[model samples]
Target: MFDLSQFIFFVIGCLATFALVCLLFPHLFTRQKKFYPKRVITAFESRMFTRLKDAFPHHHILAQVAFSALITHDQIKMRNQFNRKVTDFVVLDREYNVVAIIELDDPSHIGKEQEDAERDAMLIAAGYTVIRYTQIPSIRQLQRDIR
Candidate 1:
């Protein structure tokens, strides 16, 4: 005896009202994001470092650029390693497969050759090419090896 159509219309009206409120004041329905303050460097640091890297002149000044060049020319990609993983650098192919694991050895790595070799071996076992760059060579050298 009761009207089923009237109940359906009432439910639809409530849903439409909620949707309208969400559309008008979208942030209200959403939970407020809490900010956890902490001292940490961000990707902005990398951009700033990139700018600084331009002004500074050194042997490896062009390392970042060389990485980009390799990607552009040979269809590769380099991503920054945030985790303190064994590998310092990872090179990926167009298919996102790790093609190379590069380590830029500076003074800090002088006495750790054996340890580094072990890491390289691990990467090799995983089917990745390992490249250790002690001295940042010229662009020509980078092109020869990367391509």
Candidate 2:
């Protein structure tokens, strides 16, 4: 009951239908570009220190930590908290206003007490609770602060 001519037409029609479907929904065959979050790298001495910001406790123990522990959605983390920008590592409140600012400092920061005071003042003026930590804080200290 099968005719060769008819079989050829059916095959062509099926191929055409598939091609039409592909054209209508190109995503079926085309690859979409993947999205990636931007990582900010600074040129200061803390460039090395900043990279450690993303590291976890015992690296093997906690592979992934909560975003609330490190990241904010409103603004990107800035190297300087109070100078040119509004604040660094700013966390917003329920009202969507800045609530907290975290500053990371190197050992040299010990000599800049006046500068630190001024930066803290600026952050406080903008209603942000600023917490400055050493470039190499102990895991215990970081855990306590994060908590």
Candidate 3:
């Protein structure tokens, strides 16, 4: 016999099961977020960024520039190589032409020399300048390197 109390308990049990499934497998019921806000630069990069602005007062300084923005290749493979690569900082002339690509190499770069050189060679081959610095250079040094 189907009693009212038994029917109410069955409904509550079904609701509890549904809630448990939703909680355990949220993706089944909710869309997952794919992206989030992030810092554009690190503390070291931020310090160098301030120096870039001061050293090149008349020029434009852009941080975290995608390599794709400054270089292009007809080959899909070549494009893919740089498609996700980002330069630390890009210095531009008053006319907005890229004067130099600066990569501030911290201790993290100790074992990445070969990789960095390969990336630099790719940029150099494309007729762009790539400058690497282990530490913040003197303003005069920055001027000398780019000029």
Candidate 4:
């Protein structure tokens, strides 16, 4: 028959070794810094965001937010695939449900028509109203469009 005492000692030795390694190399188990400087919003985006905030005082407006934050994906593959797409701005109701997404179209978006369209399609399919603006619209227009 096997020796039970020997098995217990071996298990203890393994546990002690793991603890010693963790203590000696604590950094290996710690998370590394992954954030760096990045603009939250461009000047135009800032101006439009301010207008949106004023127009919809009752709602919350988030700028330069990832699409994943606004919607849930049942499939892990789809979620990971689309997690990198960022929205220009998102308008949320009092309960924090996304009401709409606003994109400020600039010169840079000219060549990205297909990509933008795809993103818009995805957002729309997810039941969010998507609005694109070439220039900042008046508060009244925003109110009318959003409503």
TM-score of each: 0.42, 0.36, 0.79, 0.71
Best model number under lDDT: 3
For candidate 1, the lDDT comes to 0.53
Instruction: Report how far off residue 94 is in candidate 2 (Å).
Output: 7.6
Clashes of each: 0, 0, 0, 0
| Residue 87 error, candidate 2, Å | 4.5
Model 4 regions lying over 4 Å from their true place: 1-36
In candidate 3, what are the lDDT values of residues 1-147, reduced to their tens digit?
879999999999999999999999988997867788899999999999999999999999999999888889999988998889888999999999989999999999999999999889888998899999999998889989988
lDDT of 4 by residue, 30-93 (tens): 8886678987788888999899999999999988888887776888988876789998998999
Q: Estimate the lDDT of model 2.
A: 0.53
For model 4, which pairs clash?
none
User: Which stretches in model 1 have alpha-carbon errors above 4 Å?
Assistant: 1-84
Scanning candidate 3 in windows of ten residues, the lowest lDDT window is 27-36
Off by over 4 Å in 3: 1-22, 25-29
Candidate 1 residue pairs in backbone clash? none
* lDDT (C-alpha, whole model) for all candidates: 0.53, 0.53, 0.93, 0.90
Scored by TM-score, the top model is 3
Order of quality (TM-score): 3, 4, 1, 2
User: In lDDT terms, how accurate is model 4?
Assistant: 0.90
